[model samples]
Target: MPGTVKKDVVVGLDIGTSGIAVAVLNRSSVAIQEPLGFGFCSSMIMEKGFIGDSEAAAYNVKKALDEALTAAGVPFTTAYVNVDGPELVIRHGSVKQAITRRQVVDARDLIKLQQHLCETVLPEDVLSIIQLDNIRFYIDGEYVFKPQGCRGRELGLSSTVLAAPRRQMDLIWQCLRNAGLPPTTETVVGALAVAQGVLSGVERKLGVICVDLGAGMTKVVFINHNMLYKLSIFPAGAGNITADLAVGLHTTLEAAEKVKKEYGLGLIAGDVHVPNISGSGYNTVPGSLVHKIIKSRIEEILDFVKEFIEELDLGASLPGGIVLTGGGALLNGLTEVAQEYWLMPVRIGFNSLPGEEAPNEDAYRYTTAIGLASWGTGQVYPGMRQKAEKGFKGRIKSWFR
Candidate 1:
């Protein structure tokens, strides 16, 4: 077998419902300057957020990847991608080991604990664990960040596990294979990737929420103490808002989408001119009516988010507030509307690159994809980069087997 060459460049591919976003980043660059190039293509073959046709999805994925890589003047084979919606499953599990002998714990022990968690049995064969994230290690009932040198008689690992149902994994893998790429070292949950790219370290510790509104689904991510504490997917997103507008105003889906983008949260102070709805289908729907529709649906989604947070009993405690990303976040006035409903500080999430140069006006749309690339470059230690599952922490594999 040929040894894997260490990559100075990495790519993040977000196969989202509304579109597929690809971002190329330099592994050697500072965190803010890593963006090399990025691209997004509408996901025509993804039906309601799942891959309806593997061939079509792969083709689109390849096209997006090539577009970004070519623009950046970089080359790549395997890249990390995001997974969510139908194939997405999250659960909480804690695994503990008795040291038996009170001895110093080492890197080997931590790696073994993670592997043991991953290799542990699941409820069914259809599901496979991808990440044992947000792990907090404790030695002899005391929480510790660096447990490798600690002496302890007992060790515990607690984390939120990300798993994929077989079909979801297959669709994404097939797309990678058809793209002529190597098998991924591992996959990232879409919302988890978004958090990595958008939320700052301080925000994560202060507690925060990320609402990734894609065309097919809305991924709600809650973070506290710099880890993904909880996540859930709502079946509808900005696409559904477009659909509702189409039905309510008797306009075409395309026109409704345009209007939604142009005047989202439609809370403008004056009468707004409706474009694209002229001639036969022309009917002037008041700007207020449009905002009303958008606000209602958005509020409903916010309500669900509120309910979820309330369940965790941290709704009132998130000083960092909510960060909204994804293509849907581009909608005008969305941040204002979100703040109104959540009663917390709200901001549209955008990645900070090294310089003032903006890749595109809609850079926020690629938040998750940028994260995938950042993560590919070792934002997450080991990050499925090792050839062996048991590879030591900080050991970078030259290539994936």
Candidate 2:
């Protein structure tokens, strides 16, 4: 048998619904420079996290991977892909078991506890389980972070468990396979990667809600006391607003998208003139009407957020405020809208890495991809650690692995 050689490169591919974003990082350096390569493609044929046209999706993924590889000047294959959507499920639970009076608990026992919880609570189709914390354990009725070498007749364990459906994950795996690269790891959407890039220690400890508004989906995670409590996804996104404009104005999607980028506002309070696009005379639509359409969709999306937060009873629990990121977060008036709907202090999320200059003020669209690369190189904000899940957390950790 021949010994396998180690590869010097790590790549992070965010397979989004509206497009594909590929980021390549050099592993030998402590800081990440400009991405070795970056590529994007329109996600025209994907629906609800499934690829409708394998050929189109495969082509996009391949082009992105090839370009990233070329820019990084690395030829070795394999990548850590970020999974976008799977209707993530999260729960907090505790387990209790007896320990020998004189024996010490260890990491292996924690792993055993995790496995036991998985077997007891997770469904058969679960693609991953991330143990967020060992949390505090009750040993002989005394709570402690570490129970090793402690005498106790009873041990209680509490942790966060995050799970995703297996079918939702197959799409990403299949895409990578078609792209001529085996997936080295598969991470959950809006998880450790985003936390690494956007969250601060104070924010995590004081309690914060991170919302990633992508093109086709908006994912949210709530952190309280440095622990993740809630994760949810909404179907409506910036793409939905664009589609609404396209249909309402009877314009081509491209033109509608252009109008959105150029003049779209989430809530227009007064009358505004519509531009003379396509060399036609200025066609006017009521600012209120436009606002109504955009607001309706955005409100629906935020309503989902509210419902999820209320469901988890986290609305009052999170005090660090809300941070919004991802491509769709660039939409005009989105932060204000989120504040009004989510009823929290909202701000745009940015990536801050050592040595690398902050991106252009207007380049919020690339936050995720930039964060993806920064995260891969271990330049994330301080205090973020990879949660524990082989499929999801493991894949996220591999950027540094």
Candidate 3:
């Protein structure tokens, strides 16, 4: 592979239940990126992260690409795809290597160990492996991050693999191809991407859970020590809230969606006079009613987040607390709701980008897509040098040093 240069551009494509987002970034180095263009297109082809209609999904993908490419004034290349964890079948695998002598562990040693781990036997139900990231490396039975040049008698590798049903993966590829997009580098979970873009190194080390409240599904991602710890997706999402408001308020889905955003915070903030909503059914209804509806659904979604947190006993011990991202995170007063539920510090995600309004406003909704672009463009995040290095010179330097 060639090295990333000043003009090397990457695209992140986030295919969500309610819409598709595209983010284009110009990579400067291992950690620096500048936004070129961003495009967001709404579609009804996806239902809770699953593609309900393949043809419509493909067309929507193209429209999103066109929007982004035209804005950036650049041609298409391979994109990084953001597929939430629920769409994948999760598995844990580990491998061990015996070191007869206490010698310096080099990059090749780590690579071989990872290759062994990749040989993990999959269940017959698995279709294909989407992506394998992060590893709990060990030398002489002690956990380590960069294992190179360590004098140890044994090497070990442990990691989580995200795989998907073959048909589902195929449909995604077909949609991309039909959209005239290039091949994808790897599949990334949207929550994980959001975490990378939102949480800092110290925050991850302290402990943090990033929940992406997307339209179709709510995704939970746990981060610690600057590595991906766990990821999961739930069936409930902000869309459920919209549906609830639509039914409870006796309004059209569009009207309910508008009302939800306008009055979603309820009395938690204050009342807003929505003139668009009329008739006896809504004219006298206080914003509290709308808040009541939104709160009920949001509480249920937070409960789902609680289930995953319990998996690792992340209930009350997380010092870095919880960070919210994704389109669903845009709802007013959502952070307050999350804080009340967890009894922990909660905040909405914003771009880590410096000195600019996130290369565009409304960056909160596009956090996952931006993170995906970093992966698709092979641009390393601030602390992922070990995973991004490649090529003969890079290899020789590692071995010789």
Candidate that scores best on TM-score? 1
Clash pairs for candidate 1: 4-398, 32-353, 32-354, 33-354
For model 1, the stretches where C-alpha displacement exceeds 4 angstroms are 1-7, 30-33, 97-112, 119-121, 137-155, 267-281, 286-288, 354-359, 378-380, 383-401
Instruction: Tell me the number of clashing residue pairs for each predicted model.
Output: 4, 0, 0
Model 1 accuracy (lDDT, Cα) = 0.73
Clashing pairs in 2: none
For model 1, residues 1-401, the per-residue Cα lDDT tens digits are 48643446778888877778888877765444466777778776765446888998888988988888887886765477787874577777777887644477866677777766654534555765555577678888888877877898888887676777766666666777787665544577878888888888899898999888777778888888777778888887888899888877777788888888888875666654444444364667778888888888888788887777787787367888898887778878888877877788888887866233335666666788888777755443454323334242212112231
Worst 10 residues of 1 by lDDT: 392-401
**Residue-wise C-alpha lDDT for candidate 3, range 1-401, written one tens digit per residue:** 47635466777888887788888887744567778787778887876556777888888888887887787787644567776536566778888898644577876777666545645534444355555677678987899866777888898878876666766666666676667665334567677777777777788898888888888888888888766778788888888898897777666688788887876664744543433334434433556778888889988898888777778876468988888887788888878877887778888776754225334545665677888876544332222332422222221111112
Error of 3 at 99 (Å): 9.3
TM-score per candidate, chains pooled: 0.82, 0.74, 0.79
lDDT of candidate 2 over 216-272, digit per residue (tens): 888887777776666777776888988897667655567667767755555566654
**In candidate 2, what residue range of length 10 has the lowest lDDT sum?**
379-388
